[model samples]
Target: MENKDSKSEMIKSMAFRLFLDRGYDATTIRMLSRAAGVEAPSIYHYFGSKKGLFYAISESYLEDYQELLKESMKHWGADPMNQILGFVKFAVWYTMNHIDETKFYLRYRLFWPAELSEDMEKHFHKTNDQKEDLLRDAIRVCIETGSCKVDEQTAYRSLINFVDSCTFNIIFSNWRPDEQELIETWQLFYQSRIKLGKGDFEL
Candidate 1:
């Protein structure tokens, strides 16, 4: 069982590196096998096909994001604003730690085989929408408690869209810099836009 787990992990690590370094289309079983130090046919034995491998990579990345978000939500029992901030921190931290995974997903989400990409998107968006719904529920509670003054769904959607744009831009902006600068500037940006209400803070 331990060897099986190790081999499986080796396959996934090699597959991720190959898919990122070589475009998915340019990567082949023989090449992956060579890089992974396995026999040419061994990759198929592990992953079934290149498509399956890509899907697994995509799923693994998305699952990491989902798990982080869920973990962040643990502190947010009944507060909308806190819930939103928890999500923001999770997005920032996860993207910072898993930069390669973010790069792999953002680059290849729509580039690989169409069917596989579509299926991957479907699964990702389902989890994404579930997270948004949780945020929306918190928004509804806030509205009921008079803590915020906006339509619940609109606040939820607006906040989510803004955060999603920031998260993706931070990951794929091509502005390579110190992670501290990136995270600090982004946190500042979020504070100005989403955390502070419109006209709530001075530049």
Candidate 2:
């Protein structure tokens, strides 16, 4: 069972790298099998189809990303501003460190075959809602604690758009901002636009 699990993980890892490098339309089962050092049938045995493999990879990557966000929230304590900043920092660092996963997620998150589109959309939204809830909860605390004065819906949307924009600029564009630049950008957005507090929140 352990060996089977290891082999399955190896296949998924290779498939993820290939999907990241070559994209979903370009990557083939032969490429994945060769890269994974496994028989072509084994790919079917593990994932049923290329799309299935892709779905599995997406699911696993999202799960890991969610856990990282949760950890960032936990590590930064109850201060809403600090939690938000910590999550942003962690997200920027994670994107740089896990370029392939980031690329895969950004590019292919909404791309799916017609038959799987509904299911994929539901799954994606479910995960996204969980992530949004974290931010919404933090913003609610901010409002309650007098850290910031913003409606939860508006604040959450702005924060989401801000983070997505920052991440998109970092990953998809040629001009890459360094760690400090990314951190500062996040801080500036909150401090300037959101008017998070009268004093600077520790980043």
Candidate 3:
């Protein structure tokens, strides 16, 4: 059973790398089998189809991301701004640490197989809604406490867009800011928007 689990994980890891490097449409079962040192039939036996393998990889990655987000939120204190900063720090650190998975998610997230796209969309929406709600609640607290000057909705949207774009550039583009540099840059921007006094909350 242990050997079987190891072999299955090996296949998934190899397939994930291939999909990251060569993309989903260009990757084939023969290539995956060769990379994983498994028979072609084993791929089908394990994953049923190429789409099944991709879905499994994507789901696993998203699950990891969700856990990281949840864990980050647990460390938040009374300050909503601190909570937001904590979330961003975890996000940036995760992207830098898991560049391959981040690249895979960015590249193939919207290009899933037709049969799976609708289901994937629903799953993604559900996951995103949870994150959105968390951010919205934090932003609301910031507004209520007079720490943030922007409206809750606008602040939430802007922060999400800014973080997503910055992280995407850090992963996919030539930008290679270190973890501290990324965190500090975001902290500066966020502090400028809010009414927080200097040294109130360290990023």
- C-alpha RMSD values across all candidates: 4.3, 4.3, 4.5
lDDT against the true structure, per candidate, is: 0.69, 0.77, 0.78
Model 1 lDDT tens row, 6-121: 88678889989988888787888888888878886667776788887777777777887777777777886666666766666666666667778877866775465554655766
- Local distance difference test, candidate 1: 0.69
Error of 2 at 180 (Å): 5.0
Candidate 1's C-alpha runs over 4 A off are 110-112, 146-153, 172-203
Clashes of 3: 0
**Per-candidate TM vs. native?**
0.75, 0.80, 0.82
Question: How would you encode candidate 3's per-residue C-alpha lDDT over 30-99 as one tens digit per residue?
Answer: 9999999999888888888988888788888889888888877788776877888877777777887888
lDDT of 2 at 169: 66
RMSD of 1: 4.3
lDDT (Cα, 0-100) at 194 in candidate 3: 51
Q: Candidates 2 and 3: which is better by TM-score?
A: 3
Clashes of each: 0, 0, 0
What digit string (tens of lDDT, one per residue) describes model 2 on residues 2-93? 59889999999999888887877788899999999999999999899998898898899899888877776678987778778877777777
The 10 consecutive residues of candidate 2 with the worst lDDT sum are 194-203
Q: Model 2: runs farther than 4 Å from truth? A: 113-115, 174-183, 196-203
